[model samples]
Target: MLYQITADGLVLFHLSFILFVLFGGLLVLKWRHLVWWHPPAALWGMAVEFFHLPCPLTDWENHLRHRAGQAGYDGGFIEHYVWPIIYPAGLTPGIQLGLGCVVLLINVLVYLRLWKWRRTD
Candidate 1:
């Protein structure tokens, strides 16, 4: 029970991190200081998708789930959770690369906006 709750919290935190990695630049537009935080996160996010790196959060979640006597899921958290909601088909390598590219593009645009805004100020 405790393990399950912790695992659930981990999932929530993982999702929050993913969202931040994608859109934290928008937040940084307001906070400004988050500029330092977002780039590394965005880079890590891109690397994870582009290289198929195994995230420790997923592993810890799976470990907790197994501890709670639940069957752990295969694949990364996005494949298990987010992919189904976004697309009907399974995530292919090409799709994964595209996703990474999308992240890169979005962050690039966000940073460009930030740069332009700073120049004006």
Candidate 2:
């Protein structure tokens, strides 16, 4: 029971972190106070994907899953989750690079909008 709870918690954590990467910059746009953290965190998130590093959350989740006697996936979490969203077939280098670009571009656009809004106001 404890292992099941822990595994579910870890899965939620992984999913939330993905959300943070995808829309966190918009949060910064809406709340200026979040600006200090969003760019760095978003960049760090992108970098982790670009370099194919296993996130600590992924590691923790895998550990929890292992404890639950489940076999965890081998690739990074994005490859396991986001790839299905972005591509119908399995991931290709072009798709992977595009995903990275999309993440970076989203944050850049969010920051630019914030900058423009700040200047106009």
Q: Identify the leading candidate in terms of TM-score.
A: 1
lDDT of 1 at 85: 98
Q: Candidate 1 local accuracy as lDDT? A: 0.94
Each model's lDDT: 0.94, 0.78
- Which pairs clash inside model 2? none
Per-residue C-alpha lDDT of model 2 across residues 9-70, encoded as one tens digit per residue: 87777788778887998888778788787777788778776776568877777787788888
**lDDT by residue (tens digit), candidate 1, 7-121:** 9999999999999999999999999999889999999999999999999999999999999999999999999999999887899999989999989999999999999999999
Model 1 scores a TM of 0.96
Number of backbone-clashing residue pairs for each candidate, in the order shown: 0, 0
State the lDDT at 83 in candidate 2: 68
| lDDT top scorer | 1
